[model samples]
Target: MNQLKGVVSHHEREIAELRADRELAVAYLKAAMESLDDPDERAAGLLALRTVAEAHGGLGAVAAEAGISRESLYRSLSPKGNPTLKTLLAVLKTMGMRLSVEPEHQAHA
Candidate 1:
């Protein structure tokens, strides 16, 4: 494991940064949410929420507060995850956030 020494993982660093600043976490999540509409980038969006969940509270805590089992939370937030709208709303509500809709900037062709 010598090679693993002094290596801070992306997840760890991301969580730490999010936990340290609420505003940053909000911006981070907002940006991640934008990617949700793109199938090619959706995984990144889910993973981003997972990171914030890991930051705002431990997964277990967030899951419990969101009225879901920890295992469900983990599975739903996985890269290939497909969380239901109910679950997404629940998770966001638990984390003091919510979803909003806005018109895309691209003009209709």
Candidate 2:
């Protein structure tokens, strides 16, 4: 019983750490998204995606998490590549993030 308890405790700790790491990755992605209007937004987003990919493991790992092929991930997140909405959502989900929208404000005269 004591050994089983220890095992459970260890697993719990590991889960907590994973959750924290995931939160950090989500924050990084958000920042990258917000930087989209900047001159280097594309590069920044790619870098952030790469970092998240590395953290989660690698391209293959991220692809697996996204339920797609490694080649697909490479193409979708590539600088000149275009990805469909489905692919984007899958990748975001793999990175523990999601898409959201907010209303844009109109300019006052």
Best model number under lDDT: 1
Q: Model 1, residue 29: what's the lDDT?
A: 97
Q: Candidate 2: lDDT of 77?
A: 72
lDDT of 1 by residue, 68-102 (tens): 99999999999999999989999999889999988
* lDDT for each residue of candidate 2 in 1-109, tens digit (9 for 90 to 100): 3354345554345444445687766776777766544655676675566556656666798888778898987877777555677877887777667888766557999
- Model 1 CA RMSD to the hidden true structure, in angstroms: 1.9
For residue 95, what is the lDDT in candidate 1?
A: 88
Instruction: Name the runs in model 2 displaced over 4 angstroms.
Output: 1-20, 37-40, 104-109
Clashes of each: 0, 0
Question: How many backbone clashes are present in model 2?
Answer: 0
Model 1 misplaced regions, further than 4 Å: 3-7, 107-109
Error of 1 at 9 (Å): 2.4
| Error in Å for residue 64 of model 2 | 2.2
Per-model TM values vs. the true structure: 0.90, 0.62
Root mean square deviation (Cα) for candidate 2:
9.1
TM-score, candidate 1, is 0.90
- For each candidate, what is the lDDT? 0.92, 0.68
